[model samples]
Target: MQDHISSLNIAPMHSPWIEFRPNRPDAQARVLCFPYAGGSAQVYHALARGMPENVELGAVQLPGRWDRRREPLLTRLSDA
Candidate 1:
């Protein structure tokens, strides 16, 4: 299996939140993946289950979508 997938560090203007499924601890390495624009970390919910035995999958859930649907959507990519 690959050594890693993807990871990102987001410092939001306000509070940020993260979520994940149950995970087991082992000698395997952990990988965090980020989704593309309009994408959400929930998409990777299965990653923790379908990932290789030696790899851990984690996803990033950015605000402004599903959870923040009430929030205004940004049009310009840079504005997001």
Candidate 2:
């Protein structure tokens, strides 16, 4: 079962994927991690150490509150 799915190209498809490349250059699989809304990227800093030797850990950094302080947040409600 695993072999069949592995045949397809399943690279990181998540938006703003945090790439945590392993020290080894010949790694096989990479882990794509995501955070919930209003979450910061720093939360996943220690994820690299918990992952397997062959698997690379990656966290996505979305631009909203923490990353972009200069940018103002928009709040609007649309009524039907």
Candidate 3:
């Protein structure tokens, strides 16, 4: 299990829109979360704290938030 977890990659990408918090790569399931309206991926940071060691958590960041300041806020629901 440790080996599998160690093999997981959590590097920040160039987009700066996706935030990943890998707790257990060996886990059978991964939990992916989407940020709320006008919110950034970091909004889920606290929620990841109580996740079991066997569960991996990933947060998705949208434009116009956090590091994506240059991006325009999504106005249409279809864009989400």
Clash totals for all candidate models = 0, 1, 0
- Model 2 over residues 1-80: C-alpha lDDT tens digits? 76764565535443332545443333456666666766755676687777766566676665454665455443542310
Better of 2 and 3 by lDDT: 3
- Candidate 2 error regions (>4 Å): 1-17, 21-25, 65-80
Which candidate leads the pack in lDDT?
Answer: 3
For residues 28-77, what per-residue lDDT tens digits would candidate 1 score against the true structure?
A: 45566777888877788876778766555666666676676677766776
lDDT of 1 at 6: 26
**Local distance difference test values of all predictions, in order:** 0.58, 0.55, 0.70
Candidate rank order under lDDT: 3, 1, 2
State model 1's lDDT.
Answer: 0.58
Candidate 2 achieves a global lDDT of: 0.55
Candidate 1 stretches greater than 4 Å from native: 1-17, 25-27, 68-80
Q: TM-score for model 3?
A: 0.60
Off by over 4 Å in 3: 1-17
Q: Judged by lDDT relative to the true structure, which candidate is superior, 1 or 3?
A: 3
lDDT of 3 by residue, 1-80 (tens): 87876667654333355566654546544677887666778878887877887666778888787887788987887986
